[model samples]
Target: MQQSKGRPRTAGAGQESSAERLDGHGREPTEDAGHLRYDDPWYDALASGWGESAGAGEPVPAVVAAARREDESRGAAADVYLEVQRSAAFQEVRRRYRRFVVPACVAFFAWYVGYVVAATTAPELMARPVAGAVNVAMAAGLGQFATTFLLTWAYARHARLRRDRAALELRWDTQELTRGVDGGAS
Candidate 1:
């Protein structure tokens, strides 16, 4: 009986030979069991920086410098963001948004809860026929849907009228600050 190279082959081993197990790369398996030789040309090309700009020699230093510049720019942008956050205009915008949202949420939730409570505790009030089969409950439920649509329209109108222009100006200012005169980070 012929013996396999390195370790002895166990009984009922799969059909793949040692060469096939090396991923068909034409490289032999190393003396260390389960380790294959790194012979792929693609990895070698990547290591040598193939297909990159011919003028830019040695990519590591350039990559490091770019990363350092990016970090510094991010730090500067964070400072700008903080300044914007501290500004009265930003504060006012946020305040207005919260002012509208908080009260609206409270009012809507109260209305919804009131409906639920009335439905549960006041069956006679809900069941009283208005015209034919339509009752107070049905009308109130339909009112809830109408209220949702109305609130949505009102919020949109409020944003368009009171908030959109201010927000847009703030965004433009922020962009100008972050990107300097030449459209690059100063």
Candidate 2:
């Protein structure tokens, strides 16, 4: 029952405490739990029931199963995309794209380089008048612009005619496959 003026009463060497010892420190808890009575008070966080799992070894399996299910779903999605890519329809779409793009790129690049080389090496040819004021260089430059527009139109027309429908069908098929993974919801 010894007490200091500012400090609360500390446990005497032989004094018995009535409050339960939660964290094994035999220091008696103060009546006012909101206030800190001692400099080094006992903190039994587990006694407040905050840090507890759902029984012994029950939560581990549920967490592992959830993670494994997610991994399986992700792997299934990747497999679906890979299967579509390896399919004949997808190969045809890629082939059509390359068939148009490769030759067009080479032809346009060669035409541009030829214009530059001709303008640099044979300026007199470029300077020769096409009609009145417009020279060969001007005509060729205008042709470059015209060909760019024509190529753009042709590319759009070719995609619309050849690849777009098949690509759309592939996309729908892909979505259907993924939906099957989700048990085919409405």
Candidate 3:
């Protein structure tokens, strides 16, 4: 319903009529009538950005779609970042290494100490080397080092894989969110 200056303001029949109404000629209303409610000018004024145009039912430009997609990719990246932060796989890998690595090392040292004591206390066993110059203590120590190295390597690999998976998930989610926004805006 368009209101105009000097027009009599009356309520519909059966509704109480107003004794006085503010006709559309308020100083500001006269100055901006073209941009009044229900007009394109008003909508344009409210729409200040590219997203606003999309909100106004305007066909978004291709560049806008691409930009939205990029934004979505970033959001996806953020999601992956969060998932990695929450992932049990990543936590478990770290936990396992902490729980077992030190204990294994301690056990190795204990075994070496025991072997050393046995060798010093019993020369018969020490004299009989398992392989030229390499007796039981040397063999056990070398084996312990090998096991430690392998465990460290395995834990590192597992942690790396978990991080990568989390990153990939975030990337995809960001892309999808952007795409959804683009479609709605367009």
Report every candidate's CA lDDT.
Answer: 0.69, 0.70, 0.52
Best candidate according to TM-score: 1
Q: For every candidate structure, what is the RMSD over all alpha carbons to the true structure, in angstroms?
A: 13.4, 18.6, 21.9
Model 3 agreement with the true structure over 1-186: per-residue lDDT tens digits: 222322433555233222211221111233344644211212222223321221233422323344556577667656655765567765664565567557766876786687678768976765668978888667766876786787688657855665556556555665565556455342
Return the TM-score for each candidate structure.
0.63, 0.61, 0.30
Pick by TM-score: 1 or 2, better one: 1
Model 2 RMSD in angstroms: 18.6
Pairs with steric clashes in candidate 2: none
Q: How much is 115 displaced in model 3, in angstroms? A: 3.4
Candidate 2 local accuracy as lDDT?
A: 0.70
Clashing pairs in 3: 72-174, 72-175, 72-178, 73-174, 73-175, 76-170, 76-173, 76-174, 77-170, 80-170
| lDDT digits (tens) for residues 94-147 of candidate 1 | 988888889999999999999999999999999998879999999999989999
Ranking by lDDT: 2, 1, 3
Better candidate number, 2 or 3, judged by TM-score: 2
TM-score, model 2 to reference: 0.61
- Candidate 1: where are CA atoms >4 Å away? 1-65, 181-186
